[model samples]
Target chain A: MTTITQGHAAQDHAHDSHGPARGLSRWLFTTNHKDIGTLYLLFALVMLFVGGGMALVIRAELFQPGLQFVNPEFFNQMTTMHALIMVFGMIMPAFVGFANWMIPMMIGAPDMALPRLNNWSFWILPFAGTILLSTLFMDGGGPAAGWTLYPPLVLQSGNSLAFAIFAVHLLGMSSILGAINIIVTVMNMRAPGMTLLKMPMFVWTWLITAYLLILVMPVLAGGVTMLLTDRFFGTSFFQAAGGGDPVLFQHIFWFFGHPEVYIIILPSFGIISQIIPTFSRKPLFGYSSMVYATAGIAFLSCIVWAHHMFTVGMPLAGQMFFMMSTMLIAIPTAVKVFNWTATMWRGSLSFETPMLFAIAFLFLFSIGGFSGVMMAIAPVDFQYHDTYFIVAHFHYVLVPGALFAAIGGAYFWLPKWTGHMYDETLGKIHFWLSAVGVNLTFFPQHFLGLAGMPRRIPDYATQFADWNAVSSVGAFLFGFSQLMFVYIVVKCIRGGKQATAQVWDNPEGLEWTVPSPAPYHTFDEAPLIK
Target chain B: MTTRQDIDPELQRRIRRNALMVGGFALLIFVLYIVAVALKVAG
Candidate 1:
């Protein structure tokens, strides 16, 4: 066995060649970061489709209402699994995949500081996904306690709940390992002259994100473990019968969930930071402020978790404190929005797919953010809480926010990946369709939510039917728009114009400095960077 | 070897390319978004 030795082995892996893996062993035992990153991404894509399929079922059931397509119980399972699979199985892992592939390259490091752990961290995922997916077919079906796994309700879930718990444990362990790997790599493995300040913003955002993961994910693991114990071993971590408050579970859960929000968006921020500067033909405006704003958002995120639980009967002081803190987040977030716009101001600009999505992100995600601030008010939340408004708010942030960034990053880098330019016409078609479909899907929901359509219900009232129909049509259009993306991406991979060494007309990063398709190994020995 | 004067010609080219491309794309995306809002719905 090759010793999973320390140091630049990871860099060696991160910078692996575009050529075929000649032997089976290269597929199995290799410690190359890029190979592993590729594996993570492919796995996430499969998981995304799987997760997206579950959502389709949820939507189908809600299509006309009256619980026509599914039993209420199965509907609950769909909601839970849809959320779980997407978050754990797809989105978070996808970002980590990008990190593994890009971080070392961005930092000019050879690879992750600890390459072997990186392997193990990614390796654990498929098995974990298998375990969770397997629960769906089991006798009692998968856990129906929602992704939150609230007590008493969670207590009533089936033997499949055990599988869900184990699956979550596996996922938590993987995330922790990945986060630890990131923390150490960023701290220890930067190129010789690369200081913390000199590091890319994506790296900076991820550094903070990694710290959040390490701090908060353990609480998630601990909470879920207690649920396991509460089921089998008679612990009262969440059981009121054992004199434990179930509400305390929300505390532990949101501690993770809140940072988890930043965890999702921070990388997207890094992506925007990268895209904005390159596309704007200028240095990023207020670079230091952008960093501070990210840190500010992260800091504000920790205190605002209570806003989610405002209706749970906290004291007035507690309620007001959470209220103010949640609203305060907008200040930093607005600072970021302004910085992005300012970077684009008066600059000669063109719109490629990446910039297309990034610009959309600022507008749509801010709308979501504004709604989130609306929800932060205890009284207002009592009205909008668990309504379609919440649905609109989150999908706005996640769809146009996180998912857009991922797509944008992919398009931005596609030329480099395949050494061929994707068809711009088809790309614009895909972009237009998605941009239209997404807004149509979520925009009407604000009205439905205001009119009192509760979330997670399989059916709705007659009044909601019109909006719901509109939403479903939008959903189908949005789903169809993605097929174009797949078509464009797959076609580009097969054949296109030979990309120049620098794919973008104004590319500045180190990745573009290499050949069109980067050599299997980049910077094998430390380059003498002037 | 480490001096700023030793910056690679390739480096300057990449920077220029990144500048124009990033800027150009930014404008296009914004216009696309604006056109999106106005195109079908505009009376």
Candidate 2:
């Protein structure tokens, strides 16, 4: 036994002596969590541009309406591709990137419990994304039935249908594997004194999010796979001609879809939770309650899937159940909003870029949340369903809600990642532009929708024309402003003011204990979390 | 010089076991979904 132990110890020592490998091979083959984290972040960044370019196509076409740029088919393709790429390719992976970089460190684990699985999880994404994007070039332009891929219409989508389904399967598999790794690492690998309750909010949020992923991703896979078979294998799961119900597809899709929204937002909640307290220079107010609120949100997310399908003509009972459950989600979400406010109340607050973004997320996400409550009224939804009002509502949630939190997270941690401070002036400029651009882009759509303009169209009535034009201009400004964010990140990485290990003034976490630009490998020995 | 083997063996076993359980649970849900769909088609 002693001999075997010595041999294992020697192997570990040798492993520790090496740093990252040279060149592209390092990223391609690395099992290091930090390397994988960097790969996920970079990949998400590239996809953001790819996805954003698609948004620009959408906005430019909508600039003056009347099909100014692409055909209607292509316009539908842009909206479809934009949502798929942003949700799966950009936002999900970006949060996963943060998890990879921060989770083990926060919990004081040596590395992910399943390091090889982490590498596989990230590598699967690019190939999956490639398959999905390549569909746009297929004989029939991409999956144009919106990201929902509602059947019958989706069934008619050209050769891209099978490829897109396969891509969804791959994406689902990747998420499941990543989720498993996170659960195992958090459950089994926390440093000795880091009890579950004692974990940082980011780690707790991710733990819950991972469980959400494991539960919901498989359902999406099954739904898409059923779609694949219906298209090619003579199955009629959603084909009305064969007595299969079309509404059933909506049921299945939203069962996965609604939780997927929380999957996207919950991590942002975690990020904001971390930022608000830090800027406030206070221990997180209501830390335990914050954790419970997150769990409450996740639980509520599962029951509220039917809320998205209110227009599908469910029985009044079903609609009432879904509406009430969705409204209940507001209780926990409001608790969170209140906690963040309380954390900042009269504490010597400073508005660094991260805090600025978090503050924007607070007010704007509330706007989104209030709009969501408006839609949750089953009676109100009949009027608002599928209108640009719905469009405005979610963009408020996602752009400022999820996307801003993500950008804020990046700012919060960029100094640690690069060992250099990003240009503060440029970050604030980026923030203002993004804030202004987002409101200008989506806020007008509310007016247009109320005026009876439907979504996913290439042209609009002249009465709706004014808001659409303003929205288009806002989209351009928002699109161009993101370029500055890219520049800020790149500039910080290349060179800037040096950062200390703490990065911020006495932030509370094990991560702050490590050197800035956190070494290639960390926590080889598990930290005792006293 | 700590290698994977240097970590506490019992903890390692627990991690591996729990990971498999989670992975298995996800796969089970996927399989069950497909089975339900198949049953519906047959019916």
Winning candidate number (TM-score): 2
**Per-residue lDDT for A1-530 in model 1, tens only?**
01111233223444343454678767566567777777787788788788877877877777786878889888999999999998898888888988887787776655675678788898899999999999989998998878988887998887888889999989977887788778777776655566677677888889888877766776677667777877877766677787666887788788778888888899888888888777878777888898889999998888888888888888999999999999899999999999999989987788988889889888888988999889988888999988999999988888888888877877887787778999988888888888898998899999999999999888888889988888877877887788788788889889999998678876655566556665555545433232
Candidate 2 chain A: worst-modelled 10 consecutive residues by lDDT = A1-10
Q: For each prediction, how big is the interface RMSD? A: 16.4, 2.9
What class would a CAPRI assessor give candidate 2's docking?
medium
Q: Candidate 1 — which residues are off by over 4 angstroms?
A: A1-20, A528-530, B1-43
Residue-wise lDDT of candidate 2 within B1-43, one digit each (tens)? 2234387778778989999999988888888887887687668
Off by over 4 Å in 2: A1-15, B1-5
lDDT of 2 by residue, A382-459 (tens): 999999999999999999999999999999999989999999999999999999999999999899888889999988
Evaluate model 2: give its TM-score: 0.96
DockQ (Cα-based) per candidate? 0.01, 0.54
